[model samples]
Target: MTASLKRFAATLWQADGRRFPAPLSLLLVGPLVIGLCVAFILPVGRLLAVSVWNPDFTLAEFVHITESPLYLRILGRTFLLGGVVTVLTLVLAYPVAFLMARLSGWRLAVATACVLVPLWTSVLVRSYAWIIILQRNGLLNSILTGLGLTDAPLPLLYNELSVTIAMTHVLLPYMILPIWAALRTIPRDLPLAAQSLGANAVRVFFLVVLPLSLPGVASGVLMVFILSLGFYVTPALVGGPETLMVATLIGQQTTELLNWPFAGALAALLLGITLLLVTVFNRFLGLDKKAAS
Candidate 1:
């Protein structure tokens, strides 16, 4: 190995500063490759192994996951929540991202800071903050009651509504940043040129800007959906029993029931679903092609 590496290094220098041999390039990436194997591959391999193995090899855990209505319902709910959150984030983020892309100077800096500061805050803190605002007789309810919007406080906290609101707030930045990046790559001249050609502002945006920014939208959707699927803390704090997700169920299996095999099965199922969605996104939405461009 030492002699081969030496030969590869010598070949790299002989080619001047223009080109590198395959072996030399691989050597440069060796640390990154090893780190990925150690950090990601091994853990995933172990999780897959645990899903199939319970003392001896077995399929019972997976069978339970498939056969149990409770597990199935939670799994479905997790996907549904992820989809809803992704859509909500996209709707809220697009305008902000568009404005950020168009703005410059101190205005752009301030807008960027507004989006990033919340992301820098801890998720736990944000979730708890939502709890304070959404609870009965809390800030929202107090304001509503003062305005005589209703006779009494609304049931806001500890439900699906609160969960959706909090999760959307937490994940909004993920959607905005990618869309902003995609929008930034687009030249301002294209929109102006479209307008000069007699297209209205709305038509110019739809025909030119929106299509150009789809890559970022696709990226943001995929990221938010995946993150929402595995969310634990926010849902736990803000959501009621009716809004239980797969991740929460997995936690219960692992900690409360001491069912490692069942937990592994749940985790594997979630991982499989995530991979399936990514495949669909890449195939249908052309996310990979868009991102590359």
Candidate 2:
């Protein structure tokens, strides 16, 4: 095995007995590395610089954010919103993904379609659909009135609840796909084997199945939360001004106020929070390492 690997490595390096010090794999990955630096790192570096220096070094933007309680509150709200959406999606998606994983034939196709069709649908369309269902005198209120559940239309639209519902619907498929992929890869016999060993359905799930599915759960949680934090249109469309999120605040600062420095600060702070959370998540869960295995 070692000799075969050595022969393969030698062939990659030598044209005429002259070895290039850099490995071929490095050469292959060089473009990807350069692309990442150009696309992600440089832009983020510039954003950080803009937050601190307005032609000259200044800490005013950061100070303004720190001194005012509003920005901090908005930041907290954004994280809270993300967390809520993540939990809702996880609860809703787990069963759906499990169903998708367990089924076969046309049933599987139907289940898969139900999960994916919404994805191909536009975000704007989906948000607008929520607005129609949730607005005063809309479908939900109409139904409630017809059923005599309420004397008048309940206030459903343009609130945190409305925003949460819309966002959860939009983000559900993300959670479902990762978990479905994970559940799909589980050995079909593991649960059956557990049952034979005197484990009931619930025990088999809580022990063998749930533990194996953690990497997917971790991935889905991270993706949904992060995506929710950056959401703009759904919140703006379904929520009132009082339901201010960090994205909306950043948009207001950039366009309405024309406060680019402050906007950069907000963006930088959000980026920092996202990175910090991702690092902590990966460290605690070892998501990528476990997922790869």
Candidate 3:
């Protein structure tokens, strides 16, 4: 058996006369490529097919969704929510990220734990906790009454503000970690050099550090914005019926209304928009370069 295997190996190597690593490389990667196509690509393709073309390959679903004022309104609202959340996360995460980059040893670990501890907690639990705090007769109202701020409890839960706040909290880590990594890569000397050249700390950060770390910030914003677009639970639990996002609309169509076609179409539209935005980010920000580096 050994003699026969040796003869076969020699014949195979002689037949193609190629490097040894090339065949092994293809053998290693082929399964991964096939798995990705089967798992992600095929499902996304079917979603797109259902969205744009209904039974018998018609564009009726696309027309139905795009031409309706209600659908357009929901789409506009989804985008607005995502935009607001992205901006708020940036504002909130930047200071956290800056502090993380500047800290060291136990301080760095403690700060990182502070950022990640909330993420480790369940979103449902957090949402419900917010509900308990924000309810009419909840902790917030009690505190307000104690401070003599108001005569009675105020309505805080089940509104757009609550949704925004909850989402910002949920998605905050996604924005912070990447920006912190980028900020950390920047040499400490660069800021010192800027200072020596008569630039103030704010000027140095805005001019020197921020631009260089922009790739990470942009990447984080892209992820948070896209994730915000599909958020369902927080808005559903906190904002109630008045603040319905497209994900909730899709869920209602699929489960309650028994309209799979419309749900599939909506899901497909969301996937397309997200992919397009990510592609644009990759193109504009040299995402590949930053990632490789």
Candidate 4:
């Protein structure tokens, strides 16, 4: 055994020896990387080309989007809706994430299961559930009426509020998962150290926990915002004219009006915005590190 080991080491040290990486590595990676580039990258390239490059390479599409007050209004509204959904998800997810991180064995698992259970269910089904809960004579409205808050039901569904609620609900798991993971990475000793120095729980959270958790919060916010920007099903289901988002507008233009070029332009712009935000997030918060675990 010792002689065999010495021979093997001597052979490896030979100047003409070849490297030993598996031949299957390239075969495994090449096709997958090429497939992604061909499927996703090429289509996005075409959409961006159609957005700005017409037959004569004129700036007509750009001008139309910028000049039209309606387009600007829709763009602003989409951003506003995305922002609100992102904020709502953050606010709702933080406590859930903290509890999941701070709890022990079975309690943590149960909490995580609850958050993920909704994610496994269909978004359309959840949206429909919200509709039933928020509509006139719906559960929420009936409760409010029974409580003497109002004689008539409130207009809850078919508006921005409904859309925001649904989108936030749909994207909440994205916020919670990242935040919980981030909180888990924090050593338990840090909070104890803060407390040992006479700091209260509130101060420890705001000073130590919150700062350490910002990376996760940033990642989750970006994820929710990007998802909300491209959301069509929820907005289409719940949003009225007052709550029309960019994705629904793009779909209407392409499917109903047959304005393929305009729809392509809108879609390309949305994709660009999503990529830009993600790049910015990676630069600021190191998503790669959190995602690795």
Candidate 5:
């Protein structure tokens, strides 16, 4: 069996040449390419087909999506929520990333652990944990009431605020990791040199550090925003009925309504929006150029 396998391998290599042919490379990746087509491309193609396939070709699903005020409102809210979560995560992650980048020894390890440990836990677990913490009689309310901060429990869970907070926590690490990677790449002496040339600390950061870190910022923002847009589990667990997002609506259409065509249309619309946002970000922020450099 081993000798036969060796002979087969030798035949394959020699049949191509000393240097692999383009077709050989394609053959080598053929399984992966086919797998992707089967797994992703075919499903997406089918989805697109179904969106227009209402017994005969039609645009009724898309027409309904556009004409319905509720879906339009939900779409707008999804984008708005994604934007808020991205901004929040960026703001919170930057300080942690900066410290992680600058620290040494055990301190660096500790900071790194703080950023990464939560990621090891399941998203469902994290969302459930937040529910426990933010419920009417939960830990947060207990502490606040105990501290004389409020007479009654504040409405913390089952709202936009709860969803935003949970998502920010869940997505914070993605923002931190990229920004930290960017910060680490920046030479330490650039800031020191700027300071030596009579630049103040704030000015050195603005001119030297912040400018260089924009790549990471852009990357982190893009990632967090996109992920947040598709978020379903976290929002469903923590969010109120009124806190509807595109994903939840899609889920409802797919499972509750059993409306496959409408679901496919919603999914396609979301995919289009995602692509549009990426194009806009790349065009205005130049994320691609910054990443290349």
Candidate 6:
């Protein structure tokens, strides 16, 4: 087997002029590629087939979706929720990441723990934690009442605000870690150089820091937005019926209604849109190229 691999590597090296690494690398990655194709690609292809092939190839499921505004509206709402959560996480995470980048010793450890501890916790636990905090008589309301902020318990749970807050909390780490990684790569002298050039702190951040750290920002936005689009637990727990999203709608069709074909259609649609968004991000940010290197 060793001799056979050596021969194969030699043949590939001679066939390709680039380098031995270029042709010899496939052997290392070949098994994982095959595994993904068998486990993920084939199943997804079958899912797409199921959506359009009810007895025979037909567009009925897709046509039904287009004819009714409900699914499309829910999809739009999903995008809006994702955008809101992504923006919120970015705004909140950037400052946290900046602070983390500057800290050292125990302070750095504490900051890192603050970002990662919740990430290691269960999503269900976090969702329910929010429910407990935001419920009508839960933590926030009780504190508010004690402080004389309101005459009675506020309706905090089962609303868009509650959903947004929970999602922001859950997704905040995704935003933070990427920005932190990027911020860590920046040299300390760059900021000092900007200060020497008579640039104020705000100007230095916007002009120097922000542009240098854009790749991390792009990565964080992509992750948070994509995850938010498919969020089910947090929204379902803390949000009302009026706050329906694409994932919840898909879940209803798959389980309650037992409409697998329709559910498959919705799932396929979501998958398609997610792929398109990823492609757009790759095109704009060169993330794919950066990742490959």
| Alpha-carbon deviation at 146 in model 2, angstroms | 1.0
Give the alpha carbon lDDT tens digit for every residue of 170-263 in model 3. 9999999999999999999999999999999899989999998887798899889999999988999999988888999998997899877788
Alpha carbon lDDT of each predicted model: 0.91, 0.91, 0.88, 0.86, 0.93, 0.89
lDDT of 5 by residue, 1-293 (tens): 99999976766665546676566678989999999999999998898788899776889999999999999999999999999999999999998888889999999999899889999999999999999999999999999999999999999999999999999999999999999999999999999999999999899989998999999999999999999999999999999678999999888888899998999999999999899989999999999899999
Error of 3 at 24 (Å): 5.0
**Per-model TM-score versus the true fold:** 0.91, 0.88, 0.86, 0.86, 0.90, 0.88
Q: Can you give the lDDT of residue 152 in candidate 4?
A: 95
lDDT of 1 by residue, 1-293 (tens): 99999976677764567766777788889999999999999987887788898666888889988898988888888898899999999999999999999899999999999999998999999999998998997999999999999889999998888999999999999999999999999998999999999999899989999999999999899999999999998998899677899889888888899988778888998998899989988899988777788
By descending lDDT, how would the candidates be arranged?
5, 2, 1, 6, 3, 4
User: Once all C-alphas are superposed, what RMSD does model 4 give against the true structure?
Assistant: 5.0
Model 4: per-residue lDDT, tens digit, 59-142? 677678878999888888898999999999999999999989989888877887899999899998998999999999799999
Higher TM-score: candidate 1 or 6? 1
User: What is the TM-score (0 to 1) of candidate 4?
Assistant: 0.86
**Candidate 5 to native Cα RMSD, angstroms:** 3.5
Off by over 4 Å in 3: 1-35, 52-56, 289-293
Which 10 consecutive positions of candidate 6 have the poorest summed lDDT? 14-23
Q: Which portions of model 4 miss their true places by more than 4 Å?
A: 1-25, 278-293
Which candidate achieves the best lDDT against the true structure? 5
TM-score of 6: 0.88
Q: After superposition on all CA atoms, what RMSD does each candidate show versus the true structure?
A: 3.2, 5.2, 4.4, 5.0, 3.5, 3.5
